[model samples]
Target: MADTTADGVERRLPTDEARELLALVRDIAHREIAPHAAEEEAAGRFPRALFALLSRSGLLGLPYDPEYGGGGQPYEVYLQVLEELAAARLTVGLGVSVHTLSCHALAGFGTEEQRAAHLPAMLGGGLLGAYCLSEPSAGSDAAALRTRAVREADGGWVIDGTKAWITHGGIADFCTVMARTGGPGARGVTAFLVPGDAPGLSAAPPERKMGMKGSPTAQLHFDGVRVGGDRLLGAEGQGFAIALDALDSGRLGIAACAVGLAQAALDAAVSYARERRQFGRPIGDFQGLRFLLADMATAVEAGRALYLEAARLRDEGRAFGRCAAMAKLFCTDAVMRVTTDAVQVLGGYGYTADFPVERYLREAKMLQIVEGTNQIQRVVIARHLVGPESR
Candidate 1:
């Protein structure tokens, strides 16, 4: 029953600090982010400066240890902040999520020296990061990644591979890259925190996406990209496990972003319903649109609660991978429905870019595909229920 602003849901935050932090985030979202989202998105401009602002605000590292210059907020609070940011602009919210995902490896597994050396600048010093795991062929089958990292005679590493679907691809200050170092398969993969300006690093042009045009997504290439031995994130041959753990948390971020998008669509639909009139009365007075609005609201509320439940489980140190998958699947699917319904509520007007629902609908589609597709999410959940597929 955490109090939400747009829908009037009640919130009981864990601490005064969290509540204040959320309030600050909401204010920033409303004032600084939302007003320019449409124009910026249409221009296909990435809001790198805004991310720097978030870093300065201590928002980029909320879920990590405070000792490493993070805010030390639990998933409960961090996800809610993402919800608010996403409601304003999917690019900003999802950008934060991707950045957080990029930082997960070192934060969760890096040695004290490694963390102390790099984390302070990463979390709050305005350095944007990207996660590099998905490859052109791998997709959901991460173990099938072909990117190779060979050990140098000096015990350093030289990576050679292309990482596809990378957010902030060309612009990131750092990348958490996974490359096969041993034999073929998951165990052979290892993680490294490579500088964005590393030797032989390059990026392809950003993909022309259907939505979230303000956030860049592209392929990154590492051609003999060199990194010192100190750049290794965790033990060698442990990258897949780390990647899976990061995805579990990243899924929750997606869920929160999905709920935010749905809420915004619901809000717009409701407002339009009350204002737009037919037969000399408000359209909302009609039973058909009224029921649709009701259903949309209910779906949004349910999605929000679902993600929060999963977040709470994560905060309590429970096994939440199954629940995270569920939340990602449900919330993203719900957003697609809610946004489509929002367009229906607006009728012809919704189809036009003059309104935001069309954009919301397009953006909702991306959630279904990222952080593992909805199909992949279902597979993850099914494995938890029935045990790792019949094969």
Candidate 2:
């Protein structure tokens, strides 16, 4: 049951197992996800049941180690799965990516004891997670965050402050939180694993978003929330580094999602063009529409290639941050263009709720803003090319 792309872009999967995994993903996406996307999104319904289904199917932990109940698949394979999910619905794909990001600190830097205690449940026990880094005042300047975690005499910590724009905020089971434990700047930060139901830890109402209403984005408040010393992830003052590492991988996820979104838009436009007759012939027969479709298809393929190249570099243990940033910038921008063209091809119907293109157009805007905005990505790429800008 191999899936075929309308654009004829060949996926270079590493093994038979990867191909089988992709087939399963596509089947689940088309059957369970795509069919309900529009209705659920319109109702602002968060699909917790679908997430449980994904967890039970071993789709939640593909990029993690099998020792902790994960599938132990490579990033390339995992990202392609994300693409399939995003093509079905952005809420599901981005939710998985955020869950992965939430688990990163403990998986990559936790002690043996901590990993033994938590990784199994987080990876496969149906627990959903969130990453808490950005605060009310520290969106782009993440290091300037004011969330504070203070040590107590009994080897415990008390955390206080608010985290803004948190995905899955109210419903997540656990959160990986970054708080200031020292003086100032990036080096002052420390990471901790906090239980969602901890005393004084609560979430504000979800945001009234323009798109992705099916996914909750809210602010989490920590009002003297307490945790044991063992909850500290990695060493104190190393939280910022851990966050940056997680973001490098997360950017690749965003790039893959953007490519999937563009692919979906292109498919919709091509199908509409081939069916809708304008002047005793299909609109697709017109040269003007044909060129638009060609450009849209080309952008989708190019975006896919860029993300896969970054994923390969990561799998091969090479320096790929610059590549990841480039992919995020280019692929998200491509989706913005591709989705807009899709709406154009659909004409007036595209602008209404009667078609999905308008929804895609709305969803595409968020990709350009998340996981570091496109402007920030360009700054990161420039730093790799000619070193950091002088202060």
Candidate 3:
């Protein structure tokens, strides 16, 4: 209900509740996260310890029901916390997002029996989970997934085939897997909770990736892995819809990460322009360069606005899928543009690992590809505007 002009002063500072929570996030990100980001990223290490710290800090379950050891914060607030973590390090933020996405099926549609059984470890962050919707054959066409889960004589199911591009694949305690159970297309799909260490469940070597290196990606092989009927999330034929719903939220998380990455890039660019000397003058003194910084900063703010708007819609329990797609497309492209220009603003220095800009550039790239590619986002937006029944 209140707004503030540019500069540190606020016409209305956040409410006491919001400010307190955001402060906690900032403290953790600046003190605990910023210090180790570069080193872990350089070493390509998955920070299992960092996740535990986040869990202890009450962040791992920030938007879930408190009955399950969660913080019960609104998505609007939770997303801001994610943004701050991402500004410090994209890997940890993305890992949190993936973990949250993995919890969606169980939380949204699971039976009371299922929730009671799984939500404690998941919401408590004692164990991490991966959402397995993408397969070797089904990246964007998720309904086309080829993996199968056949009912066995014992009334259990045996899962077969592989899931590709799974984040946290090697380290996740379990996976929310989608497999074919009926006829072809979306109607055939069912969701299963498959443990990572289950017999016949193995991860391929971590993928050689472009960025978010500290967050590993791999293929999960399921060679007749067995799961109880109780492990199935929701009823048969609902998995595809559930997967898309999860992504609607997951894409918003990616959008927030992009905003944070853009903000970090803008900060670096501003600092560099102010301090770096060019022709016996600060680069900030040059209007040509200063304008670029202005644009980057503007994009950062705009991206924030976009994600926050979508998040608010989500919190209101409104239809926000189209908004999520728009946020993902715009925010990630903005991050790419801003980080690339941040490098240009710093000249040769930005191109090197000596500064974080290069890393930011590399990191911004995956934001476009993950959580559905920007191209896919455009298609989603187009569909929503024209309506599915439209010609």
1-391: candidate 2 lDDT, tens digit per residue: 2445445657888888998899899889989999999999999998999999999999988999899988999998899999999999999999999998899999999998999899999999999999999988999899999999999999899999999999999999999999999999999999999998999999999999999999999999999999999999999999999999999999999999998888889889999999999879999999999999999998988988899899999999999999999999999999999999999999998899888999999999999998899999999999999999998
lDDT of model 1, residue 51: 89
lDDT tens string, model 1, 333-376? 99999999999999999999999999999999999999999999
lDDT winner, 1 or 3: 1
Q: Clashes per prediction?
A: 5, 0, 0
Local distance difference test, candidate 1: 0.94
lDDT of each: 0.94, 0.94, 0.88
| Model 1: per-residue Cα lDDT at residue 209 | 91
Q: Considering TM-score, where higher is better, how would the candidates rank from best to worst?
A: 1, 2, 3
**Candidate 2 TM-score to native:** 0.98
Candidates' RMSD to native: 1.0, 1.3, 2.1
TM-scores, each model vs. reference: 0.98, 0.98, 0.96
Worst 10 residues of 3 by lDDT: 4-13
Write model 3 residue lDDT over 1-391, tens digit each, in one string.
2433222422222356766777787788888888998888989998898798887777778788888777888888788878888999999888888998998898888998888888888878568889899988889888899999999888899999999999999899989999999999998999888887999999999999878889999999999899998989999888988888899999999998898888888888988888999799998999999889888888988888888889889989999999999999999999999999999998899999989999999999999999799999999999999866445
Pull out the clashing pairs in model 2: none
